[model samples]
Target: MRSPVEPKSAGAWRSQIPTGKALVPYLLLAPFGCLFAVFIVAPLVYAFYISLFRDTLVGGRQFAGAANYLRVMSDDKFWAGLGNLFLFGIVQVPVMLGLATLLALVLDRGQLYGEALFRLGLFLPYAVPGVIAALIWGYVYGPVFGPFAQLAEAIDVPAPELLSREAMLFSIANIVTWEFLGYYMIIFYAALKAIPPHLLEAALLDGASRWQFVRYIQLPLLRPMILLAIVFSINGTLQLFNEPYLMRVHAPTVIDSSYTPNLYAYSLTTANQQYNYAAAISFVLGAVIACASYLFILVSGRRRRR
Candidate 1:
């Protein structure tokens, strides 16, 4: 019906132009894509590029291939930091998430007196800046002037040395749990609220007890949120820096420059002037986080299938 030239000249332009809903997804994603590429992707690429080079006074910056990465693999400080995170995560994450889940479920029931006050009180700690929270807790863990120590003295009992080497990990974990528990609880509470009211009503009409309804209906629905929380917790755990870094002031003997991988990377850059090696350490930690998160996703997916 139309000449070939006409199709090429006119139809080509029309075909190239997206119409209506064709552009919706791209339009919706444009802002996030720009920010993600600028902030996340660009920095990651730059870090990885930096990691492949070595900077020294003798030779300046030189391409070292994977020398930095190889060094990182054998670095005892890095491994020890990771081991601390692993220990912190194993004990902290489950307890924190479980408490969050329980609190969210209880709040969602709308049975508690002064529910709004309780929610706000729980979430208030999350609003506090991480640095400020750590500082506050640092003083609380100080044996000299801390309330716990004062109370113990008043009661004629020995004060628990919370910042001692034996308890430093638990002390940091406690701070992290206190800071994040309310955040995760809000997430779970929101997910619970999103469940359709009709389904809950149906369960109630079917003579389902609260425990039975929660076990069969709510828990199943909350799995995706649970998995998301776990992944986030894993990432946060591996990147632990703030609590330990701040606590180092209080427990100088227990917390060192290389207390966590993030702290180690920071110390390398600022204290040792090893920017390239620091970047490598950072990228290595990032890779560890990615692999851990991926493994968790696979496991959760397999469990969901079952």
Candidate 2:
């Protein structure tokens, strides 16, 4: 009381304390918020900051605002990698998702004899790490020692050049499909399992055949999951790197430095030591992923509205 500062009243002090459900949300979210700020936001800002400067022999590190981004815009290798991803997504995504859906339907029928074994077998490849999976497939696709090649020799037929330029696209697609098909299948299978028992009974009461039940009831319900799977597939396709990166050892001619956008960015940083440019390329890729995902969502939304 004698000092310049006055003591706060009890009500005023109580009012300052957080209480009830309002604070609960923030308390729960605080961990994730802290992690996002430290990990995600910090790196992105730092990378962007790094991307603004260019290293030069004459001037040393100097501000070259937007120069790296401009170079990325005209970069043929980046464009080629993007194109390759597009083509890969176009063919592989549909095939993979389609197979997953079919497998889910078959397994959900409850008629398969060894259902658990079947499911586990399908999902086993996905359990294998991507690098190991790529290496395993690389050996399978090897020209000389691979089973396919050896079989062809035994039969006096020409061995399939799986790692060759013409076949490399499908070859890599095959590995991706094999690895992730089970994962997507499990997702669809779980979705199928989650369908209400009442709906199945109602459909049965209505004299709906298996095919009719699937087409009308199951497919309609699964549309959302299918869209989700497609979006995930697109994202994975854009971020393609591992298979091609490892396959380089087997097919150096086909799997070049700029095989996919991720691979290209990695090569830029490691091989060319173009850290700033690589950062720009990574940001560019992030932008592409965001745009592609948004466009697909928009299209799906419109289609659903119809």
TM-score computed on alpha carbons, candidate 2: 0.91
Across residues 138-201, which tens digit of lDDT does each residue of candidate 2 receive? 9999988999999999999999999999999999999999999999999999999999988989
By summed lDDT, the worst window of 10 consecutive residues in model 2 runs over 1-10
Provide the TM-score for each candidate, comma-separated. 0.88, 0.91
What's model 1's lDDT at 267?
97
Residue-wise C-alpha lDDT for candidate 1, range 62-105, written one tens digit per residue: 99999999999999999999999999999999999999999999
lDDT of candidate 2?
0.94
Best by TM-score: 2
lDDT score, residue 289, model 2?
Answer: 96
Clashes, model 2: 0
The CA lDDT of each predicted structure is 0.93, 0.94
